[model samples]
Target: MSTEESPVEREDRWVLNLRGMSVTKITVDFRLMLFLDSDWEVAFDASVDLSYGTAHANPSVLLSPESQGVAGALALFGANVVSAVAFKSGTLRLVFDNGHHLTCSPDPSFEAWQVTGPRRWHFASLPGGDLAVWTGSGASES
Candidate 1:
């Protein structure tokens, strides 16, 4: 199916927008899961550094747990994701570096899931500080 037509056939999806605080500089660790169909799935993890001057961050090499790899997927979607969290159930969550969080999950018309925790931020000072986020959704077949 064409890209334009794909959304019509897909029953669930979401778009997330994560914005950085007004701080001059900050780094965020991102983890995303791409739920493609029932059996196909992908995950991405990376550390992104952003500054006041630019919207897109310079991403650093991290770990990705997917058979095809994160690079390929990013290339495919042309996603320079500033911040986003998408789930199969169409739920989207956006969290800030300061532990503030927002979530959107509707009823049967897609958008069903949850996001929890800032639990703790390790570094909080340097660029190497530990940052993490999570997203959980219902299984496709479930």
Candidate 2:
């Protein structure tokens, strides 16, 4: 599929905007996810609020030595992520340039991150009001 997408595809849940034009910065906090913002009003993917602290800090976001330097791994997201990976432990990783990386795993009790459209994200509610975040790859019969 062409990376070209209509503006209408932007969803309402993703309140944050990531222009896709050279990521300016990334913020990781007690929140359950990593977020990036760019230079425009365009929306990209994933905007998770880290308020209540209801989520566990499972999985992990690690930085290589080069990615951990004074400059930080910020520029790692400057270019498109080279590859997106899902591990057996339910941890997901986004690989960037210079070997920098970011990984996260939701506690089994927490909703998994689901990507519906091409890199588009959505939340799927399970029974009893629980959620299974969609990790778009791995462990499938594709």
Q: TM-score for each prediction?
A: 0.22, 0.36
Pairs that clash in candidate 2: 112-132, 112-133, 113-133, 113-134, 114-134
Q: Give the 10-residue window scoring lowest on summed lDDT in candidate 2.
A: 44-53
- In model 1, state the lDDT of residue 117: 22
Best by TM-score: 2
Computed on alpha carbons, the lDDT of every model, listed in order, comes to: 0.29, 0.33
lDDT at 136 for candidate 1? 41
RMSD of each candidate relative to the true structure: 16.5, 12.2
- Report the lDDT tens digits of candidate 2 across residue range 1-142: 1143421222222211222434444444322223333222111122221111122533333332222322344445454444443333434444544444544444445434432333433333232223333334422211
Compared to the true structure, candidate 1 yields what TM-score? 0.22
Residue-wise C-alpha lDDT for candidate 1, range 56-132, written one tens digit per residue: 44332332322323342232232222344544443444333333332333333321223222222111111222122
